[model samples]
Target: MKDNFYLGVDVGSVSTNLVLIDEEKRVVASIYERTRGEPIAAVQRSLILLKEQMDRPFRVSGVGTTGSARTLSGVIVGADVVRNEITSHAVAALDLVPEARTIIEIGGQDSKIIILREGVVVDFAMNTVCAAGTGSFLDHQAQRLGIPIEEFGDIAMKAEKGAQIAGRCTVFAESDMIHKQQVGYPLEEIVYGLCEALVRNYLNNLAKGKDILPPVVFQGGVAANKGIRRAFEEALKCEVIVPDYFNVMGAIGAAILAKEKTKRTGKTNFKGFEAAEMNFSTSSFICQGCSNNCEIVKMKLEGETVAHWGGRCGRWEIGEVERIAKEQVLS
Candidate 1:
């Protein structure tokens, strides 16, 4: 007999993460892969890798999707639950740290702050416009400095005192870094200074006017940087908790949600491993239904329309419903 597992997929702008959890909510397997502007291919590769990692035969009891491409992922995987990034991150935080009051998530392209009280999310903010304090910017700086990003944190830790660097935006920060280097600032100090600057930017922007109480939890791809963690601890004057599965918390949270939903509904919508081999494609067009002119996206599986969304009105989604009903009647 095969064991049962819930699968979660988080397809972000820069990365695609997948997590599998058993009934007990323990992570069975997780994969993190670069999205590279191709979410569909990234998800397919991740799913194939996930199956290879599982040593025992198991059935995916439920599936959930979250992140920027949540709708597309749900359509591809036949997810039972599709949730937003904020909800998924908060749920994962609460599960790991029941007393979590704040969540600081910095991914490749964006950053967000979630404030919770008593296990419920009360307020949250996301920085979608800027790239100064995100993983991609840091990676860019590391490359410019000819340093391995993997060693960025340890090098920062060696700094005795960090030099001041502009934190408002990436351009100013990069120019300031070059100036500091020209003035003979130590490399470690410069690196740590960059970390500190990014943390300050995060606090000043997304965390402004928000009471960031402790037991603050930090997750996302950037959480792997110990230098940034230390910078956050220093700025907040509190210990920041980094979960064991920091990079894939969003997917983990989605899995937990899938488990809860399937348990309550007593069934799942998962398409099974065969979904890996299925042909999936997406297309978009301007609605032109009204002045709104919303760009509507549609996903097709095996040459049949499976899902559509992204209209201000429910026109596209309703069309999907009508199409399904017509198919049912024809069958």
Candidate 2:
């Protein structure tokens, strides 16, 4: 008998991650690819990679999506469940660390802090306005320092004393780093200092006024950096747990959610692996009905409207297209 698998996809501005899990919730295969500003193409490529490697025929029992491009991806793949980043992260964190009280997720473009009580999410905060505390900031600094990002954390670990860098903003931090470099500071020390600064900025911006308790789970692309993890541990004076699947936790969580939904409903709306080869078109139009002038995104699958979103009042949705068609017939 072919084993059943659940598929989860997370599409963000920086990267797209896809995960396939079996009946026991064990990860079967996962892929992480940079989005490069094209989410749909990235997902299609990832799916194609998954399809090409199938050793035996397996069923995709359910599908789910999360992240910034969740809606669009959901429409493309016919996802059974579509959720936000916070919910997905929290679900994955609690599943990994059942007693976790805090979650620090620093992705490519943004960062967030999720507070949980008794395994339930209570409060959360996000920092999207600043790039000083994100993975992109670290990538930029690594490039400037002439170091490979993979070796960045190991080099930081070698520094005995880190220089002080202003991390309130990316601009100030870069300038400070340059000054420290020009003054002949050790490369290791400067890199460690940048890690500390980013950690400080994240704590100050997102964890401010929130009771960040123990059993903190850190998951995201940045969590792979040992220097940043050490910085967080030193600052919080607590153990930070980074799961084995830290980089793809959001997708895992989405997959788990889809599994639960399928079990309850006994049905899945998954469009199947052939969706990887399907053509999809998306466009945006301004809604002229109200002063909000909301820009609505429309999705078409093979020349037929499948989904529409991004309206503030829900006036320009999939139903609106059907209504308009009916009105045209009446006229």
Candidate 3:
């Protein structure tokens, strides 16, 4: 555990992020890639890129896993610490702003609101069912209006008169946008209206019962959209701070978690850069061990079993592949 660097990976439905942080919890190497239907491959590619960027094969003192695909990733990379997105995000936020009261995060597919009390999570809510207020929905609307997504903020700012567009769901919002266009409403107005409507909807629905105090920090892919940032600022009537690494907050937080875990346990489980060069193969199978029928994924290297995950019964998780291989040899 002599090395001071830690590795963190956050693999979600839409994207895979890898971040390397030093002891100070500052990101040293960070890479984000689209999940592209293969979380494992995306992670491997990111790790390989990280390896190439480093001066040499350095010992990874600690490794952490987070996000929807975290369990699988933890098994694959021999994670030193496994944490959920909520913990990872909150930890990273506290590191940046020691007294942050509220956190607003919107990724490609989901959005969340976390309320903090003295740097601890008091309550939180997430909306994964609705896409109306999420980043991908905004991207679609920008495409339909023939405007670049990056310019969404500038257009919103210049909007003198805004139109009313439904923000209940994606279906209703798209139709409302079309109706506004049909009625000769300006694209900027419609865009601005949509932005406001989304923020309003998020506040009314998710942030309704929660106590949203000041010092709010917005982090996620949507935070890059100025229109959305302005919308949050105006809705909350407070200054919203967007961190320098807004999009990669989860990964950064995971790295921080890895660092903290290593310092506590004083152990390093990182497999090293040799893991990048390792010829790994992964495959999935439906486990009929129980009525749950979990879709277990297994990884192998050089014809030797490495890991198996995704079984609720733990039948396949207890060295089944290795024991089976040995049994095959004995037979």
TM-score each candidate. Answer: 0.94, 0.93, 0.89
Q: How large an RMSD does model 1 have?
A: 4.5
* Residues 141-163 of candidate 2: C-alpha lDDT, one tens digit per residue: 99988999999999999998678
> CA lDDT of each candidate?
0.91, 0.90, 0.83
Please give the lDDT score for candidate 2. Answer: 0.90
The collision pairs in model 3 are 153-227
- Worst ten in a row by lDDT for model 1: 319-328
263-307 per-residue lDDT for model 1 (tens digits): 878999988877888999999999988999899888889999887
Question: What's the distance in Å from true for residue 38, model 3?
Answer: 0.7
Worst 10 contiguous positions by lDDT, candidate 2? 319-328
